[model samples]
Target: MISLPEDQPRRISEGERDAGVRRLQEAYAEGHLSHEEMDGLLQQALTAATHGQLARALASLPAEDAGTTSAIGAVSGRILRRGVWRVPRVLKVESALGRVQLDLSRAVFEHPVVDIELHLGTGRAKITVPRDAVVDIEGLRAGWKDTLYRPRRGAGSGGPTIRISGAMGMGRLKVRHARR
Candidate 1:
């Protein structure tokens, strides 16, 4: 017997929901998502209207390769790489070891404010912006130098203002901008 709602979303199977949760978890653990972004994306995944939507959401998971391939019905069954995250280009980074690596090296942030909040253990960080770019670091355990906020000349003349906040336990954060 096939029972489905006429208008609203159909209930997804436990397998689909579980898979979605796994995907969401992987994104966060990989630093691919900021706290808020993770919340939003996970919320969407959990509340997805249907199984189709849930599947789509999890389909874009980053490729994980290693001795990571396991045979499931003559096909791979691994849902995630051991540590690979499917993160977007623009993002907020957080870590417990205080290690935040950002490659803004190629991204010309057109926005006015680029805010970053990091929670870490050792606090090692870096950022590359346009030379004209301005950076404001607050709520951090170390001073400005600990964060190598550099701007690449004219490239930063009208670039965005990048802000970073770090927790005491954080590690190093590295940011590299795109080369001209």
Candidate 2:
């Protein structure tokens, strides 16, 4: 039998279970697993009470690729990225004296988790996320204005998660989910 490290958790957490299910779904979407196989493995991941069961459910899957990181900087003009754009795993956005708008409703996300690190001097930022996206903005620090965000009820699960961080000086950050 295979043995795990002593520091490894025995019980499975909700986040871990959710991540396992996401990996299974992504594998199925990418044609790596058949429908029947995906369904069976998904059941195993869902009903897994221990970490060992969850690991077994996700065994034999393709490893995740090393996603890329990109940067966008604007000194005095507007920085807008809307429509169908490819999203990287880590995006660093810096603006000095204009508005920053990122509409990710129709964007193609390459990774399951996207991190947006904003370093704004005085420009406000507006981000429109996907309908099924889960957003986390705990690491953000607003100097003068509060972040405008409202979590909607009934948001579907197993979608890509967006993590927003960094410092916004004297500019408000507005985030909203897509309507359609």
Best by TM-score: 2
Put down candidate 2 lDDT per residue, 82-179, tens digits, no spaces: 99999999999999988999999999987777899999999789999998788889889999999999975665465678889999999999999999
TM-score of each candidate? 0.37, 0.74
Off by over 4 Å in 1: 1-91, 108-110, 143-145, 148-156, 170-179
Q: Could you give the C-alpha RMSD of every candidate to the true structure, in order shown?
A: 18.0, 5.7
Model 2, which residues run further than 4 Å from truth?
Answer: 1-17, 25-44, 47-63
Which window of ten consecutive residues has the lowest lDDT sum in model 2?
A: 151-160
> What is the alpha-carbon lDDT for the whole of candidate 1?
0.51
Candidate 2 TM-score to native: 0.74
